[model samples]
Target: MSITLTQLRAFLAVVHSGSVTAAADELIVTQSSVSAAVSGLARELGTPLLERDGRGVRPTPAGAAFAPFATDVIGLLEQGRRAAVESAENASRTLRIAAVTTSAESFVPRLMQAFATAHPGVGLTLDVGNRDRVMGLVLAHQADVAFAGRPPRDARLEARALHPNEHVLITAPDDELAARAEVAPHELAARTWLLREPGSGTRSVNEDFLAATGLAPRTLTVGSNGAIRQAARARLGVSFVSRDAVADDLATGLLAAIAVTSAPAPRAWHVLCSGVGPVRPVVATFLDFITARGG
Candidate 1:
């Protein structure tokens, strides 16, 4: 017996939705079915695909490496079907978008929806990951457009400013420094700092801030932005993150921003695309819409 589409779907569902129960709900199947499919696939592959994480679930390193390939396989099959149907109609078109984690959680959805609403004939699919994965998609010509804080300097990619974005150092609402006028770099040296995994733009920003200030604190690498947020909420450590990603939490006093010297310089969110060749019509159309309407 070999791996099946059923197993792939079940695995991806749990990866995306973060739990077997959630995956079952998303796939409209019983939790046992989702669990069995994932376990069976892992057994067939001779590896564990998931690990329990503090009452939830997380992809094992092997599973994390496998996810993008699995996503592409499903996406390509869907794309082929759409291409066949759209060729007959001669009216429908598909657009693929990729965005880094922060933008994907924030304004990118609204931008996508506005474009989709304005152009009802276009089919939109989005892939969200860290900066490295998103840029990989753009450089490989797998995605029509991408959004990120910045791309590594690459001659083949063109990036235009979408808007100014800011990162803030956040802690639980009752942190000791929240009442201070300002914090010094040395004051933070004794505290623990939360870092995103490598290849993440947030980690890049955190590194830049630390470098500029010459402060090295105890650092713990949490894998994702959501985990960092939860860590901050639990007072596990301080984290640097997009304001947009935690605006509501800040406003509601669930998280507090602490002011510090020479930290968190403002950066711009950019719309990115390949500069090496002609962009597809659907790609051009989306760029025009956002350029005119403001993403």
Candidate 2:
């Protein structure tokens, strides 16, 4: 006979609780039911799954080996249930969004708050990652929509320009670079440059800026905007990042933006969705809100 989910669950509970009585209590069932379920599972697998130790229970080698797989199966089932519930609730009034780090850090929270206020009872999930990863999430249908500085060229996704985004050279307030209201691109290039990972939009813009001016710097690559910011704050090196990401720091004088003549003009931020068909209603509503608010 095939292994039953019920039996697996009972076995896992017993392993977790370390005693059949405790497992029964946790499962809100009788101890006999737990014992019978475990025994049945062991018989089906043709192996001894548990052993009594003094006053408690312990998994035998076979049971211990099966525990992880059983837990994973149960987890997947729970996740499937959650996804179904989320999908149904989404059909009624929920929005699932994925965004690159900058957009998520700077705009998403406010957008979510406003969206929630405007559409009460609407559920929302926002996943944040780098540009490529966020786009992938949207393309895979894991997210209904995404926001990023530039839309990807993937054929499976549809993208629309939302608003212009500016990148600024930032440095710690105490750093010598902070004294300059604006540093020429070539001069800026001479400094140690902290940068985001290669695929990030900010990094792309930074590279473009260097290429346009025919300048390269001592470069140190970091993975996230937060890391870039921290590195800059530690006075390790200057970094260029989205203005939105550093707005608060710029305002507070903890960090300063170094103007550069050759800096790329602000580029358009885009909203991306799957190319399959008409956008979902919740995603549409959010896109409308972002466009209306001038992003």
Which candidate leads the pack in lDDT?
A: 1
Q: What is the lDDT of candidate 1?
A: 0.86
TM-score of each: 0.70, 0.66
User: RMSD to the native, candidate 2?
Assistant: 10.2
User: How would you encode candidate 2's per-residue C-alpha lDDT over 1-295 as one tens digit per residue?
Assistant: 7888879889988897899999999999999999999999999999999999889999999988887667656655654554566567444556778989999889878877888888887788889888878865665466778888877666767787876788888888886656767667777656788878867888887788778888777889998888889888888788768888999999998888777777778888788877754555566778788778876
Q: lDDT for model 2, on a 0 to 1 scale?
A: 0.80
Model 1 misplacement above 4 A: 1-91
Question: What do the candidate models score in CA lDDT, each in turn?
Answer: 0.86, 0.80
Instruction: State candidate 1's TM-score.
Output: 0.70
Show where candidate 2 strays beyond 4 Å: 1-92
For candidate 1, the 10 contiguous residues with the lowest summed lDDT are 75-84
In order of listing, the candidates' clash counts read 0, 0
Model 1, range 171-287, lDDT digits (tens) per residue?
A: 989998987889887788877899988899999998988888888888999988788888998999897899989998999999998898887779888899877555566777888
